[model samples]
Target: MTDVTLMDFHADWCGPCKTQDPIIEEIEEDYDEVTFEYVDVDEEPDIANEYQVRSIPTIIVKNEEGVVERFVGVTQRDTIEDALSQAGN
Candidate 1:
């Protein structure tokens, strides 16, 4: 099985992204095995567009094999925790 990574795409000025950022931080504490990557849309538009992020706060859960799940907008803690569990984090 491949390692799982969570990609969080957000902008500095986004309100909803502000809300989601903390959740990711909290998740980081609990799921240390899961890798988290933060990308600023403004700084890296190409990466964001490649992921098809039409909105801010797009959370992409990917394993080494491929993408597993995607959460757009403000993702709840439980949902993300569950995905991490499934990803073998």
Candidate 2:
């Protein structure tokens, strides 16, 4: 079971991912129940392959049973909140 997992695929050289870090950190702060995992594409190639990540700053929100619901680029606070809220329900 997933039990609310948010995986962020990123790279150290990615400017967009750096720009999006604060927003994600804020989301992590807001959603205490949600578990966040950060995978560096450069270091964790296996994970990137498992997730089929093609770009940096990819956010994958998975529910229980490891089913992915949201898979996209950098996400905003409201968007993440809404997604989490829906996942909770």
Candidate 3:
């Protein structure tokens, strides 16, 4: 099985990021096999830079192959789930 990971790059004061939190949380419960990572842009600027995240909320779905999908701003749960599915989650 391919190892999949969902990375959420956000900051504490970002309103859109706040909106995206619950969606990610819900996905966490649904996709127990996929690894989830919440990266605070303030605390982890290097990681954000590595991902080239210029927006408040950037969601990256990747697997053993590479990045399968990427979303910016407030993304819907279904869209994320679709990306995860594409990544072999």
Q: Give the best candidate by TM-score.
A: 3
Query: How does model 1 score by TM-score?
Result: 0.92
Q: Give the TM-score of each candidate.
A: 0.92, 0.87, 0.96
Rank the candidate models, highest TM-score first.
3, 1, 2
Clashing pairs in 3: none
lDDT of 3: 0.93
C-alpha positional error of residue 11 in candidate 2 after TM-score superposition, expressed in Å: 0.7
Candidate 2 — which residues are off by over 4 angstroms? Answer: none
- Please list all clashing residue pairs in model 2, or write none if there are none: 2-65
Q: Which lDDT tens digits does candidate 1 get at residues 1-89? A: 45889999999999999999889999999877789999999999999989999999899998876788899999999998788777764
Q: Comparing candidate 1 with candidate 2, which one achieves the higher TM-score?
A: 1
* Ranked candidates, highest lDDT first: 3, 1, 2
Task: Give the residue spans of candidate 1 off by over 4 A.
Answer: none
Q: Answer with 1 or 2, whichever has the higher lDDT.
A: 1
